[model samples]
Target chain A: MVAESARENKRVLEVKNLKLHYLTSQGAVKAVDDISFCLNRGETLGIVGESGCGKTTTAVALMMMPSPPGKIVGGQILIEGKDIVPMTETQIRKQIRWEKISMVFQGAMNCLTPVYTIGKQMMETLREHREMAKEEAIARIEKYLAYVGLSRDVLKRYPHELSGGMKQRIVIAMALFLEPKIILCDEPTTALDVVVQAQIINLLKDLKQQLDLSFIFITHDLATEAEVSDRLMVMYGGKIAEIGTNEQIYGKQGPMHPYTQRLLKATPLLHEKVEELAFIPGRPPDLLNPPKGCKFHDRCNVVMDRCKEEEPDLREVEPDHFVSCWRCRES
Target chain B: MSENIFEAKNLQKWFPVRRSITDLLKRRQSYVKAVDGVTFSIRRGEIFGLVGESGCGKTTTGKMLMKLLEPTGGQMLLDGQDVTHITAERLKTYRREVQMVFQDPYASMNPRFRIRDVLEEPLLIHKVGEDHQERLKMVARALTEVRLQPPEEYMERFPHMLSGGQRQRAATARSLILNPKFIVADEPVSMIDLSTRAEILHMMKQVQRELQLTYLYITHDLSTARYFTDTIAVMYLGRIVEMGDPDDVIDHPRHPYTMALIAAVCEPVSGKVNRIKDVPIKGEVPSAQNIPRGCRFHPRCLYAKEECWTQIEPELEIVEGRHWVACRRYKEI
Candidate 1:
């Protein structure tokens, strides 16, 4: 109980009832509907879901980007005990963005400016945020490059000169150059080869420990998430279906939500051998016009009539474990 | 010989790199040895997996098997018939007996055409049936074979109307409509979602079983390769470094590259995060154009010795019952 209180005190980021919608021609696409979670200082919270599950939308909302058609409808995003939802655009730009939180995008090829050299790109960020002199920024960039295991000679090279793994490390270094409280990594290793991917994951873990940085790592791969995250959040459609400790989420017969359970079973494990994998029968529910009750009701194996009529709240079923299924609550 | 329906003997393909004016003045020539002396044979109904990383030439090997790209050296046999020296007319017949399913379903199909046209194009080209109505019946049967039930619903829909999985299934249906004996499916499930991957793989397996079609399943994912293939071959730098039972190769890898590949797979299991130590090598995959001397993996091999750099190319040696490895330290390992 004392440890739990200490963790609560270390809450670096808390998202409460956050709702983001996309104003499309057909209707208001409820991309993120009433999702809430807290990220403890130095802790990695992994958000995992299929395509169109609003995982990326939640990350973008945290970044406060003015992506057209996507707007934050409501909710409190409290970072360091201060509500950021009501902050002015200039305040968000000057203080909240990059100073507190930054994002590492999916593909490194698209993220890095093609025409600019590595040193020039790093200097732009440092100069804009810290107003550091060119000489000082160059020195800082060299130091950051060393931290990410890149040679200072890479500073002279363009983005195309670097490999995918090197480009990813540079992107991470840029995100960390600001020394933000939290870093949002959206599928950082999706495009890399397996060996390169392992190297990146190890690098991320090392950086987290050395810097005491908190991470909101988002990926569709659950196994990759298990490697880094302290807690796991499983989202289906637009709502979070389950959230719990890594052990509670990935333990033997641990995932309580049917969608989470099926997802785990569907993934092919390297060590384990099974006759066949159990796949979720139907596709993810249409977010443009979400279902009436539970978003996963159509695919839930143990679905009841009540599931189709009433949406179950995310209730704490066990210590530090939350599930949004009435059957799980009863059992 | 009777059971071996498809055989590739020391297949080789070298892609010539584009030369600049400076190189032309200097009279310099360079080639990327994409498929360097690859040899394998697939049984009549076996799923032979060619597993490797991006530049390892697995896709090139698959393309060669489908005759989409001609090999610069060696020969291929279909039903004990030599295809390398076949006439254009004979090659067309050979192509009819072989088909290919690409990696990206979205890019492989024609967006403007309906599903019916996509499936019927192959039959129309091969002159499978006398009447267009007869070809439509064949299309329906092929669609049903791939589990795209109620074919009438999907027949009129364009490629954009279907999901990734549905589009891939339609591609598979189109490939099977020609009644090919062998099919090269290159990363068919890589682009789809995990939940949909198992279903598509199941459909492919079922179609292979029902039609007695041989498969050359090429993918960079080792876990899926192990789950899908019967006999697995691990490639590194355009060469087949290891070949054996998928379980044997993946569970107890002999080659350092294969070991590294298996160790690198990020599993979802807890406490297995730090399971892989040292990654068995250093640096990223080198460009295929500048492949290392001696063993292609010599630079990255953790067990590389002085002889590894200067020694002649190591040939694949049978280590155990049909398990082959091309490592110099195969005995010590």
Candidate 2:
């Protein structure tokens, strides 16, 4: 779906030569290493990676949320074809933040104030966007809650009264309250149960269509990401390892990178059982002093001599699919 | 049934909650049914998973089995002894028979104690602290039993000193220190990182085999449930909705709720597969305090009819070998 629309409007968000680093006492930790990609309007771009791959930092840089110790050393974040990385905090706050693009922060259940009622919390966002009476806001809150499939009574309860899933629903409701064109949700359902997680995933997919909302869903769970995302961008050590549709990103389009291939074989699905799940042996590269040639050279199974000495830039292997692995060309 | 090591009957735990400050002043209280009537059994060397979201009372069930939190009602017969009506002497005798692994490895182990002190404290409490040298020897052996290699390095580490996996291994060493017949591991790996989560699961499976420890592993993760558990029990709002072999329950989930939960988790098989628009069950998990009259899952269930509302509760009927489902429409599905 994203490939079809790529020719239409180019992309709402164009990330080019984006490099974010954590300036630590030990030295610069290149969290998001030289990543580049673009996202079309109303398309779900699922970013999959483990803990410290700069995926979260990518979201922070795009939203201009990263402050202090963590610095965006190099990058151009283009929203609506306008570069946003170098914008001051004030311009981003008044013009861009939550107005053009908004984010449902990771672990949103804890995002709500435990003391306030849901109604008051929803009104906080509503008041920031537009001037409305308390009664008008209350009625709109009930309507938005209904859109997220929750009843009006949820607004009457405290954050402690709501379950983890309910708290997530409220977050989605808040993300949509201002009705920004693009929404970024980071590991939205990690704390929820499986059944409740399913509900949240379905809600986002349905809302993506109904509201014509664009979403950048970041997660470690590749299975659910495949279910919801139109296109997927696989990130490793802050670089774009692969970018393609779900069919291309998942095992379908031949994975040029051994890391992608190994990750595909390892994840445990619903029906199948294995004697042992495949593990991508060895940890991710230390960002401070990363490997020289290919970033994946250490963990790659079919590592060639050339892969050890030369880093390959991301290029089209097939039609729409792109990979940065040196061995990809041979494959 | 042949491997059944721990059997529980009518397990119940009730917590009294005062309605308000005024109600507390008036000395009025009402029972919050944290864990209502529940019953299940776990097999020897088998990972019997109890899957549920929070407030479904699965944790309460695990606590009741361990006798950590005193149950207001019910009977627990471990390897054949009724632990419901036991005294301090009897409890001390039963202490070595049953052991529990808590959720947070960080908080579970005492912050003040070293790894050896924490493990050997149980042995000491049960009056096995006499042979300090031999207990130290057993501590090293217990650490190895749980797959923590070269136990000497781990002996001096406190709860804060080690990684999550190592801390959990240290905690498991504490549990296995007594060489208990049954281990109620209540979300032991929940707090660990995803990378080491599997290592802890693999290590627990090995510990189960090496020590003949029967495990009632409580978790919210279904893929691990499918991978590790021999039998699985899907709990909802303090009741078992489905119970049977893990393959039977996971593959051909009889209950709608079980099917939804499995679908929610259980990633699509690794391949460039066509995406299916998942119809995530639309609704909130109704409060345990306000359970629906008939089927607990009726509120969000797609196939619910009027009969599912205010009528008799569906009894657990045998569907196939070792498979029991508590829903009337299971046959139709």
Q: Quick one: best DockQ, which candidate?
A: 1
What lDDT tens digits, residue by residue, belong to model 1 across residues B182-211? 999999998888777888998898888888
Q: Model 1 chain A: which ten-residue window has the lowest total lDDT? A: A272-281
In model 2, which regions exceed 4 Å deviation?
Answer: A1-8, A129-143, A151-156, A251-254, A288-300, A303-313, B1-3, B20-29, B110-133, B154-163, B193-195, B269-282, B299-311
Positional deviation of residue A70's Cα in model 1 after best superposition, in angstroms: 1.1
Docking class for model 2 is: acceptable
TM-score of 1: 0.97
Which segments of candidate 1 are over 4 A away from where they belong? A1-6, B273-277
| Per-residue lDDT value at A202 in model 2 | 73
Lowest-scoring 10 consecutive residues by lDDT in candidate 1 chain B? B269-278
TM-score of decoy 2: 0.89
